[model samples]
Target: IQALPVSKTLQLDLLLGTTQRFVRTEPVRPLFKQLLEQVGAGLGEGQGLDAMAARLAAVEREQFQPFEDRHPFVWKNLLLNEFAYAMFPKGGAADIERELMGIVVKFALIKLYACGLMAHRGADFSLDDVVRVTYVLSRAITHNRRFLPNLLQTLQDHDALRLDVMTQFVL
Candidate 1:
């Protein structure tokens, strides 16, 4: 995947709030860097989606636990913002958002799978599973907007009580 060339202004805007009140970007920068390092550690050149998924699934929760525990608010906010940006269009940044959404979805899926909530056939997890997990996670991440509600309902309609249970279980 090509790295999104984030402008300094946009980077600052993301780390610091757009509002009048001053927000610190210094602390957030290292966190972002650590996130990038964690995500990129296992990726290799010319790898397919299956390879990517396998690597991600193999990632231990401990790798992310410290970050999540230390900065829960910032972590959640970053994820929520990523989802919002990915779902909605930002002017002149459609490409960036698309790339970002892909990463966020993958990361979210990995986290879910690591928690043993998702089933897989080795490196190959089903697209249906992806949709189901993403839907559940997005809902948990933000109640303000529903992402792929129709698809989630369709999945639940077919899958019986599993998805409903997942919704209850995932935090």
Candidate 2:
């Protein structure tokens, strides 16, 4: 474990790429295609949305969900997880608030991008139409989930990184 250095990013791309590439002898082409298909399906169905604007209407609802069943971290803690704590520094309630904010923020951005892509794909509804339906009921944006992202950005602009600010969890 000592040989591994902490990373600023969630390291999603690098970490996933490594597994999808050299680690497997089958090559990267198939995995890439699968990834694209997964994204396409989500956009097409107006479902399976991720870190984006049109999601998490019931943030607190999802929080209490079972991890195996759905979003389990809602209203829960992130820091108690050894893996995440190792990646992010440390904090208390404020840190958890920041983490939740980040989750909401990411979901909003992803929803925007997905809606755009889905609209461009010649789906029946216009992008605006889609947004109207999606965003109207969205609890995240209504609650100003953007503040979380803005806070993170503010901290980043100061040339300092918070212990729990780098896409890691808080407890």
Candidate 3:
């Protein structure tokens, strides 16, 4: 694929292919660290979305940290959730297990990207994916009331939306 210096458009194809690489080399730790770092540095310098996105887009697989230490509780919830489960394919136990691992990796990357995008005020990343994640997180909060307050605070701090607006949207 052509590697362009452009916005933070996710290379779904590349990401899907990344699962194969995980078997060979160790996965990136602090998952998506490169992307997250770039977002922080860019925003600190008061850069715009286009600039931030371009910088984020240029990150290669080698730059990412391994996903070896993510919280099991969070990942488990994400996998079993209705929205995430729909993406799983039907298969035998072995095949299902393999596919489930890939889905876990994919979701981790998505969350990494989502968190990076959320870090910056008015910074647009992949809105469709972000919204989908937002939906899942919202559902999570509903399922467990404790998450609602923390999520609201995060939204307000990130400037994704006003706390009131986010409350209505999530509800």
Q: Rate the local accuracy (lDDT) of all candidates.
A: 0.36, 0.35, 0.39
The lDDT of model 2 is: 0.35
lDDT digits (tens) for residues 1-171 of candidate 1: 124331222211221112111112222233333333333343321354445444433433333354346546644554576667566454456555444434343343335333232222323433444344445444433442233232233334545223233322222
Best by lDDT: 3
Those runs of model 1 whose alpha carbons end farther than 4 Å from true positions after fitting are 1-50, 59-62, 73-147, 157-171
Candidate 1 matches the true fold with a TM-score of 0.27
Better of 2 and 3 by lDDT: 3
Write candidate 3's Cα lDDT for 1-171 as tens digits: 143232242222122123223323433333233443443553332454455444444332212222213233544455577345545666766666444433433354445444444444233433454555546434433444433343333433545323233222211
Span of 10 residues, lowest total lDDT, candidate 1: 14-23
Ranked candidates, highest TM-score first: 3, 1, 2
Clashes of each: 0, 14, 6
Best by TM-score: 3
Per-residue lDDT over 50-77 for candidate 2, one digit per residue giving the tens place of the 0 to 100 score: 3321322222123212321343342233
